[model samples]
Target: MPDIAPQPGVVEALGQIVGARYVIGPGHDQEPYTTDWRGRYHGRAEAVVKPADAEEVAAVVRFCAENGIAVVPQGGNTGMCGAATPSPSGRSVVLRLDRLNRIRWTSRLGDAIAVDAGCILADVQRAAEAVDRLFPLSLGAEGSCQVGGNLSTNAGGTAVLRYGTMRELCLGLEVVLPDGRLLDLMTALRKDSTGYDVKGMFVGAEGTLGIITGAVLKLFPRPRASAVAMAMAEEPEQVLDLLALARTRLGDRLSSFEVMSRRQVEVIAQHMPDVVIPFGLESGWYALVEISDTLAGDALPPMLEAVLGEALEAGLVGDAIVASSEAQAAGLWRIRHSVSESSKAHGYVVSHDSVVPLEKQAEFIRAVEAAIIAAEPSATVVMHGHVGDGNIHVLGILDPARFASAEALRARAAEISLAVDGVLAPLGGAISAEHGIGVSNRERLRRVANPIELELMRHFKAVLDPQGLMNPGKVLPDALPA
Candidate 1:
């Protein structure tokens, strides 16, 4: 750990703002906030302050700004990238929003729900369900990940095929600006011909521009009938064909279309023996298809079955199993949800969250796989993602023994990432689909993004956070030499 020199009275001052019991000084207790969820990035903070509400958060930010201490805003600390982790410089304070968790209200009339930034994603979903509505932003980390973190990353999960990303799911935001001023834009209105979308800027800013304190999120009618199926295919093209077929047959009811490589499913099966894979891993690729309807009936299952039946007859699908019960549907989803945990247990994974055009997805995957193999032959590459939205998550697992050190492994991972980017560039795909450019891809984003785009981002960052105190070293890259 780096020697973190605490500024005189800084800890005491923070303790006063948000009760001494809520303020955790540097040491073992601060470990959880300092280290990222992946354990990839270890950082050091002078103190971790848990603010009770948005006002307390603003006060803490103001104090930090006055003292010239970097403030790293954290929520749940479930981010894959090191966005929430403080820098190892130790010249910073971690502002944790976990204590600010609260569901302010659920407006069925407005079709929206207002929540504190620290509210867990699952809690938000349940709160929406309480009112017979649906909060559709979900992923493996929904149980622990906070709404603010999801908003920061503009997360895209399985349901993105139907509901869209977090950006679209959110209606408005309540942010604490760098200067400690609360900027409230929490509106539930679906239509607003507002000039310059200020809230949208913070949606995917990754806490660079401001700290997201609360949000008004859009809600939808809960699905009364749903069907889930695990379909096997010989190749990526076949999976794409099935996606097209599903869309043509089910239309808006096609909620999720997830693709997983054979290795991805096998890893889940190996690590999570309790989770059952509906179909054996005989095929090269598998897709988890889900269709949902607001109306209650037995029609959903038959509709899903008909789609799969046609695909199977057309040679697009090899074999398929539709979940006959709610328990069965949950079991089928367990396999997809278990992927991240299983992959972590398998080995050091060099993960990529890239999205390509629907037409070029197959080609992009093929070229990227080939490039990865050519770059590192010994690696086991596993692929999966929301195929309906063209987001493909590629994981290259490497043996720890092959690398001499962590630094060596990271270097190799960077090399492989570059190779994947090389393939992605030609396909007109984005380097980052949903995950924002935190520490992991900061430089990569600078290299890949257009000059004008980078310029505009820097301008916005400079205008909002002139001192660069709000979540420093995240999202936007470091300024270039004058």
Candidate 2:
């Protein structure tokens, strides 16, 4: 799609809200806002507006609201689902909130932080660590992804096994309503029973409801001592059993239980040689376990050793390696973190982020693999994810030579995604576990989500965004009734 021509005096009105320098358009300066990080989604904005704070954001939004222009609120733009990208229609304006980056308040005793939505996640973590606290949201994109996008997508990362997703980590929020009103709910209160869970409505709404301006995030005490273990297992059941043992033995200390296929390990080995993977390629599966100790003493390593030793007796562990030093532990984590990058390097892949009931995960993977292979025999599955939380990425990597063009590959991607959903739906899993239903999974969401629930979601969308101007054509299959 081509860039939309500017509405008469529209750019001038937006410039008046923030500034002419902030309201930029019509050339090379606007190129950066037109595409996503992955380069898969390309869009064109009428104008890119940089707002510094909620009031400024509201004024910009107010102009878009009055003029019937679509406003796409973007922060960092590190999303995989194209949620932050502008529309292909080129009529919308991009609202960049990066300038609002600020750590408003941090309370060590309260274990809470109030930050602007545009604050980078790693910056928040640094602020917490500076005070001997921990902000437990960690992901590959933490260095670049903004807090607002994390909360908007309810992102789940490696630490989700311990700290939970962004939704659970947040206490309150300050949002700019769709119609340009500021809703200030960024409070430090942990418990509020007065009304509905108002903050949750916008948590995973993908900015369709409003623009998240600021947030109150939960923090934790920093772990004083930690242990990391990488063990080989023959089957998913053995991995599950080993995880059960770790949870029972370590209890609250268990931080992450990541499962990766042997193929994932090989891909990482092939791509990243410096990172040490514990087990050899003899086994088809491996589990990466971590224990975070809050106490001053370093007891976690011995405890993890004891647990893995028990798993060995039970035949749940084939081969194992426990990190003796922090550098070694970081190396093991590097292996786990390299999974997605390695998979992307493999080939054209249709990735899934589905989560089933904990016990049903193995069966779900088996069923989906069986179904996919029966239909498309040449498909290869690369698996890795939070095994403790029942979320597994069952990516189907397609051969480049199979299809003649990119469009054909995408068509095949759609079919493969539906096949995954076929198995996932019957098992009561989500089409999107951590990634919200942006343009990527909105169709699947429409297909599988409860009709009544969808109707209510649309109702809420209409109520919050009466003009249907806030990130139109995202999260919902269709626009609210005009």
Question: Which candidate leads the pack in lDDT?
Answer: 1
How many Å off is the CA of 453 in candidate 2? 1.0
Q: Write the per-residue lDDT of candidate 2 for residues 1-482, one digit (tens) a residue.
A: 44568888888988888988898875567777868776667777789999989999999998899899899889898887778887667788999989989999999999999999999999999999988999999877788889999999999998898889999999999999988899999888988899899999999999999999999999999999999989998888899999889988888899999988887788778877676666569997889899997797878888999999999999999989999999888888888888767777777767788899988877987898887776567777878989898889888877878888999888888888889989998888888778777778888888889999999998998888878999887889875311
TM-score of each: 0.98, 0.96
The residue pairs in collision within model 1 are: none
Candidate of highest TM-score: 1
Worst 10-residue stretch by lDDT in candidate 1? 473-482
* lDDT of model 1 at position 111: 88
The local distance difference test score of each candidate is 0.90, 0.87
lDDT of 1 at 206: 90
Candidate 2 lDDT trough over 10 residues, lowest sum: 473-482
